[model samples]
Target: MNKLKFFVAALLMIVAGTASAQKTGYISVEQVISLMPETTRIDSLLRKYQSDSLNPQFTYMVQEYNRKDSMVSTKDSVKLSAQVKNQIRQELEGYAYQIQNWQQITQQALQGKQQELLEPIYRKVEAAIQGTAKENGYAYVLNREALIVVPPADDLLPLVAKKLNLKVPAAGAPAAAAAPRR
Candidate 1:
């Protein structure tokens, strides 16, 4: 009777172990953005904005115009003799002031919009990640980008990226921004 009881207990333990070992849980940190369309759209908009801001040819033209305008002085008749030069200088200065004001307004607007757009989306993503982890019965999760808590080797970035159709480079590789080419 004792041997039969022991055998039954051991069989139950094996069944329990097998059932609990089949987990459908994994971490997804960096690829969360790729899976989200809104995030991708916003990212593209920001990249275009940044590229427009760094326009080199336009920058050179603005600098050259400013240099010529600064060399003009209304108080000195010799330098201001050409009515055309005076007119050009006045127009350039006015345009420059307008551009400066426009840039300031645009910068403020971008800041407000970025906060408005990113904060809510970030909160939603965080909640979804937490819920997903809980639902899938994850025992542990760690961000591939911030592999500080969980064992680094257990990072699931590749899996998540593959699922989301995004690319996640290996560690020590330069980030997209730091990469030499766009």
Candidate 2:
């Protein structure tokens, strides 16, 4: 029984050592995504949409709110009846609230459009990562941003790029910015 127990313990140690030897790599997913060509097109679309549609609406709302605010602020309350003053106050408040809400809604809509446009690009990158991992015998491919410390030469960006048939751009290539979320 002691001999069998000793053999089992030895086998476990060997298995553990082998498992720990598996290849692991990290990649900056944000950087990789930003480098994708589709990102530029998506950014262009987002900018155009903001300038053409959302901005005009936002500007109109701001102008309307400003006009109402000016009227409310400049009006002589002593000359106005109580009912008229109250109505003007409520109108000003309504315009202010709508302007605030419109800004929030427009921001959210833009973010949604950005994510929608990038979904396919993200999927392609993901597929390339998985293919590279499988071909390279990597046991783990972690996101660099999530790691406390990443060893040099452990980044899989070039490897994944090769798998995707993409040319690795210069180190200082422009990064794509995500939509504003605040």
User: What TM-score should be assigned to candidate 1?
Assistant: 0.38
In model 2, which regions exceed 4 Å deviation?
A: 59-95, 101-103, 170-182
| Model 1 error, position 1 (Å) | 39
Writing each residue's lDDT as its tens digit, candidate 2 over 56-170 gives 9888878877875666567454677778778877987886787779868887889988888888877888888988888888989998878997887878999987776667776
Report RMSD (Å) for each prediction in the order shown. 11.7, 4.4
lDDT values for all models? 0.59, 0.80
| Cα lDDT tens digits for candidate 1, 63-141 | 7667666657445536565886777777787757756676675666566656666776567656665665565566556
Shift in Å, residue 42, candidate 1: 0.7
Return the TM-score for candidate 2, rounded to 2 decimals.
0.71
TM-score for each model: 0.38, 0.71
Of candidate 2, the 10-residue stretch with the lowest lDDT total is 173-182
